[model samples]
Target: MRSALALGPGAEFDRIRSILGRLGERAAGVGGDCALIPAGDGQLAVSVDLSVEGTHFRTEWLSLEEIGWRAAAGALSDLAAAGAEAVGILASIGVPRGAPASAVTTLMDGVGAAAASVGGVVLGGDLAAAPTWLVDVTVIGRVEVPVTRGGARPGDGVWVSGRLGAARAALDALVRGATPDPEAREAFAKPRPRLGLGRALSRLGVTAMIDLSDGLGGDAGHLAAASACAIEIDLGLVPIGPGVVEEAARRSDPPAVYAAAGGEDYELLFTLPEAASLERVRAVATATGVPVTRIGRVGEGGGVHLRLDGREQEIHGFDHFA
Candidate 1:
């Protein structure tokens, strides 16, 4: 448990490089300022995410390893939303004084592990000193047909991949100093980006796509705004994860609140053209092993609305400034 201050900068950098090298084939040909990859005729997709201590996460609630994985996954989720296959990740981290070198090693290991899970490699990064731990990851990916938020047209079907609210439930439990179900804990610590499902949807000709990092309500509003179309979400059609209902019921809180507004789900939310058949959607779901649920439709106009049992309901998800 030697402090980073004792290890100095050069030794720490070497340690990181050594850890990344152990990724084997995943880390092949990764070095220098950038990693090289063959683009062919397809387009390259890039996205960056920043995770800060105390703001985006609490070290007390999550281990250094979990924090690393969560941060890397957050960045990779953006590439998934673009219907891209991840190529590699560049992680720039700031370590605080008195931080243990072992902790930092665990963090890098987590990052490499997450990247390897999605066929991604750890290419290169920068390290610096800071007052608090900071993690920023830039993910590079490739997409033959890039899906965007502005592609949804009026009369298209709105769909979501996988269930929601488990991450929010885990956060709530941690804040209350209570332990949540294993599924909820995993959802918070290691969210699976729907990369396979996103690729399949792109091949299926999906109109628009986005990842559910900022909760369904807010993220759906983003898609609606970008497309200049109104989105009507049927709460009844939304899939609620296990334990969410019981937790909400016990607290006298409506489960729909979490289902609609909980953040960090990292699931894929997309829209398909009116001509897209349910059978086709089901086929993609079967192929990717990711469940797809149709919860609403795109309509003319702009904004996002919620419907519960045919009644219009008001709801909003996470907003960093609000």
Candidate 2:
């Protein structure tokens, strides 16, 4: 049997769909960011996020509050991608041996604060003892018309919200046993999901949408594959986060690599029809306080292409099993 590492996330999703067979077809959206289920008078968007101690973060690198907040924020970003309104969250925490009760409460406080910021609250959850600290959050959201990844069409302009790579730079700093700059640290600890912008885009008739959790390269590829179209990203147009250039230089790589392929940015990647005009997109930024930049265009094909320095380049993002 092949190991999970060999299959990777994309292939593993296909394997899961194969296992579910016909039953999987019942869900409105599967193998996307979140699953949409039919509810009375509307649909619910739900997603589960897992934060493992060694895998996702280190205790020395962040406070318990930051850990909890990061987990919830990442999970809730899925709802934003679906263009849903925040509802609530159910968090399941795994406590290891000798864990302090105060630690757990502090973590819960952060979780509650995150949910409340988005007009949500903790709906209750389960607890268990484990070998390592674990936080699993299931965020629920509601939407009248949920956006799906497979809605892009040729000629749609590809865009991204906010900036990218600040979290990646912070991760590199942590790995090096150094503290990141204040801005990068804030971005890493408390990423602001583009909830308002996402809802606005959905209302404005975006063709497709996905959050930048696993970096622009991988996420954009997923969008392309889902929409059965092609995306050409101009590397020069990608918005690199502050300090990312210096971080990339330290690692002997171009800033574009980190900006395009660094995971955990939690911004939105969406497409608008050519008819949507640049003025309209900029107006959204004015309204929501989040800048949206056009970095590419969708074409009639499959897969994502990156053009840097007038040539094509290949890059890969984070993969849990890999």
Candidate 3:
């Protein structure tokens, strides 16, 4: 058996699914964005996300409030991806020794603000002491009919909400000790979850849905693997966020490379039937105040393919262990 250190995030999740398969019907949502639990007359979607001090953020790179908001938004993004309406958030924090009590209060303030921004609240959680600061957020939401990642079928159109790569550019700029553009900085410090868009798509015949937390390349692969279908994305059609081209040029990398593989975007990636017209998608995008772009299509086969100027290119997404 391959050790966890040798497996990518996708493989690790697959292993988890295999283990959860022992539960049979009880594990219905184990492999998707949020675990679905039957509630009275509806299903409750729940998801948890962790932000470690070193792995997810650095103190010098972001304010305490930004850190808190980013963590909360990321956790809630899962609920959105599940096509659920936000209900509440549970936050757990680990404070290192000597950290001020005011710091905790300020962090919670940010968390509360983010939850409230989506008509949700910070319900309750536990606290602990740790060697480094950490935040773990659990989000609970309701969905009359939950969407799962495996529902995508052949002949579906792959679409994405919002442009890509600003957060990636900002990360690169921060790492290099250079100033990033205002748009890029905002994208990195405060990512907006497409809750309204997800809700709209859920009712608009969307077959499968996912949040682009792991970048387009990796997230697309996850959706493809789940649906047992192939996805071909046209690099030319992907909407690149402002400042990405310049940032890519600085590093001598193609803009498509970053747009395709950059992580922490938090945009929605979904599939709709081929019969759905672009005008319908545009209307949804307009109503949700987000831009929707069709970048690809679903086909028979497996894995995700990226085509740039009609030529195939290979790129990968962020892997924590890799």
Candidate 4:
């Protein structure tokens, strides 16, 4: 498989198409770029994301399978944020000239696996040549009531669906030429988008939501800006993932720093009105088996504020053009 993937472009592409055709047989709603089907009564939600070699991932640091899984998971996380049920995904790939056929197939296989995990399938896609490997995934979802980042209001409580920082910590370890803890590596390589949790929150009338792709602080700022509200996060309330605290200790950095500013966790961050019942929240958490934590509240102004031991702290996550 490794040797096959190292082959030249022409043969690699042919092999890729063959594999895709077989995989598409079991995946419904797959045909062309545009999928024609019956429109549901609910609203349709669509999101697109791109993952590139050297930028979003490093081939030297991760297996092709891991890279593929991360790319698809990141794209689907958007659907999870909107509280929508995924319908299908369209993948577009840019393969470097000398890249292996096996690698491309593995990448698509990862994409297919992620789609199935979210009760979706690969509808169709396009392929092209590029200087570096790239994968672009577009997700289509349906929702009775679409959640948006702009819906947060004053007095609303901020919440997160799962722990944070493991993904960032894994990246940090890789950048430093060290192997990450197994749990942290798994968190980065195979993030599970909170699709079920999003649907439950939507049903429970969540006001605003966003996936924790760009870290808690930066993503929270996005929600605040969109909703024209201020958000204050209690650092102590942030759920740091396992191994993160130890990693922080090893680096002599505060554990809260990673929870606040680490990126690519793929967890859901949302808001609910103050009047929302804690009982209902607990029920949802119990039903979904996904931990839900209240980290802060929506306030009267705009921007995200982090409070550490009652003092304000400044933190931000990843930015492509920064």
Give candidate 1's TM-score: 0.86
Clashing pairs in 1: none
Evaluated against the true structure, the overall lDDT of model 2 is 0.85
Predicted candidate 4, C-alpha RMSD: 11.1
Worst 10 residues of 1 by lDDT: 1-10
lDDT of 3 by residue, 138-239 (tens): 999999998767778998999999999999999989889998888998998899988888998998889999898888988888888878888889998999
- Please give, for residues 82-128, the per-residue lDDT of candidate 4 as tens digits: 88888889999899998888878988998989999999999999889
Candidate 3 residue 58 Cα shift, in angstroms, is: 0.4
Q: Tell me the spans in candidate 3 whose CA falls farther than 4 Å from its real position.
A: 1-28
Clashes of 1: 0
Model 1 ranges off by over 4 Å: 1-40
Kindly give the number of clashing pairs for every candidate: 0, 0, 0, 2
207-294, model 1: which lDDT tens digit per residue?
8888988788877877876677898889889999766886677677678766787889999999998899889899999998889999
Which 10-residue window of candidate 3 scores lowest in summed lDDT? 1-10
Off by over 4 Å in 2: 1-28
Residue 223 C-alpha lDDT in model 3 = 85
